[model samples]
Target: MKLISWNVNGLRAVVKKDFAEIFKELDADVFSIQETKLQEGQIDLELAGYHQYFFYAQKKGYSGTAVFTKQEPISFKQGLDIEEFDDEGRTITLEFPDFYLINSYTPNSQPKLKRIDYRMRYDDALRAYMLKLSADKPVVLCGDLNVAHEEIDLKNPKSNHKNPGFSDQERNKFTELLDSGFIDSFRSLHPDEAKYSWWSYRFNARKNNAGWRIDYFVVSQNGKDLISNADILNDVYGSDHCPIELDLDIKGE
Candidate 1:
């Protein structure tokens, strides 16, 4: 099975930039996207042979997530069950016979960590939610989690030390999540790889290869063996973030 995740930054904008061709080129069994930044009826996508599911934020043109799968899910849901967090439409869960897939767009802590408290609360809630899902089935969690867990996860880590995504608190929470029985698929596959997925438009960040590996495909420990390959498609671009892929040996019912 091939699963892919990307933070489109803005779905409508991507569509105008050959998203359809890129989506068809990837040809994944399950494709997930974050930071859709759309409200209901904002746009429509016609992806033949795929089941499209969207969870849009209550706030217009803001945080949102969606999933497109060739296989029908046994069940699915939106959000982490907290009203405040749910209001942002940051998560979507799809249950297959063999595993639970959670597509998430973790909230950014913002400038000067202005939203650190809320971001921390979100981290706690998400960790608990993923644990609950893992207890029942191996979980596959992916998206622009908005944090670079370690120094190796970004270029110029020293300079970005106190930045929003590289803050000690955010990184520690990510560590706590992994410690709770999950594996960062990309890192596990390529321990010394310096590849990154997201970059800023300013200062020619992408051109200079100065980027952050914020997008990920994380799985429950039990599901680690199922991952055949984990890749960062940095060459393909429409948004600030590139697509990350996971090739699994598991089968769906």
Candidate 2:
């Protein structure tokens, strides 16, 4: 089975840039998108042969997430049972027969680490939530986690050490999550590969390949064997962030 995750930045904006064509090219069985930046009725997308589910934020043109799957889910839910975080429409959990698929757009620790506390709270809560889900079955978690876990995850790790996404606090939280029986699929497969999924539009970052591997496809430790491949689609462009793909051996219910 093929699964793909992308932070489209903005759904409407990407659509204007040939999102449909790119979507067709990928042909993922389950496609998840984050940072959709939309509220209800902002736009309509027709994805033939796919079931679409969206979680829109209360605020217009803000953080949001959505999923498109060829196979219907046995059950699905939005949010992590936290009112404050749910207000941003940051998560979607879909249950198939064998596993739970979680797509998330984690909160960003703003510049100067202004929101580090909030981000930490989110990290702790989400870790607990994923643990609970994994207790039942394997879980496939993906999307822009908003942090570069280690020095290898970004082009200039030293300079970014204190940056919002690369702060010590945020990175340690990621470490704690992995220590709790989860796997960072891409890093597990490509230990030495230095690739990135998100780049700033400024300083010609994309052109210069100065980027951060903030987006990910994480799975429960038990589900690691099911991952056939994890990839960063840097060539595919629409948003500042590119798409990440994961191929799994498991199938839909």
Candidate 3:
């Protein structure tokens, strides 16, 4: 099956920028979006062959996520059952016949590292929740994780080491998550690839190829052998972040 995840930045803004056309081109079986920044009735999307599921943040015009899938999931969940994290509308979990799909938009640490504590707490809670889910079935977790896990993940890691997204604290949390039975699908497939999925809107970073590979498709370790491919659509435009895709061949076990 083909699954794609993207942090659209803002769904309303991109819809006018050929979002629908790009959707058609990708033709994924499941498409997940993060950082929607919208609420109910703000905009309507007509995806002919997909069933839409959205979880909007209680705060207006803020963090949000959505999933559009051609196949109906056996069950769907919105958050991690934690009120503190649930308020942000950052997660969506879909239980299929064979696996669980967890789509997330991780919290970003502010300029002064103001939200670092909260972001770390979020990481702790999310990792525990994912581990719990994995006990039942394999998990396909994807979206804008908001951190560059290693030097290879960003163009200028030395200068960014102290930056919010590239901080040691955030990177270690990601490493912990991977150590807990999850595999970064893209890195696993193309270990030497250096292209990124996100670029800074400042300083014409995108034009200069200054970017960070913060988005990801992570699967449970047990499901690693099922992965066929993982890719980044860097050429696609509209948002500062690009779409990352993963293709898996499962026998429906």
lDDT of each: 0.94, 0.94, 0.93
| Model 2 misplaced regions, further than 4 Å | 251-253
RMSD values, in order shown? 1.0, 1.1, 1.2
Q: State the lDDT of candidate 2 residue by residue for 88-161, as single tens digits.
A: 99999999887899999999999899999999999999999999999998999999999999898999999888
lDDT (10s digit) by residue, model 1, range 97-121: 8889999999999999999999999
Q: Which stretches of candidate 1 lie over 4 Å from their true place?
A: none
Which pairs in model 3 have colliding backbones? none
**Model 3: per-residue lDDT, tens digit, 48-149?**
989999999999999999999999999999998989889999999999877899999999998989999999999999899889999998999999999999
TM-score of each: 0.98, 0.98, 0.98
TM-score of 2: 0.98
For candidate 1, which ten residues in a row score worst on lDDT?
244-253
Between prediction 2 and prediction 3, which has the larger lDDT?
A: 2
The predicted structure with the larger lDDT, 1 or 3, is 1
Question: Clash totals for all models, in order?
Answer: 0, 0, 0
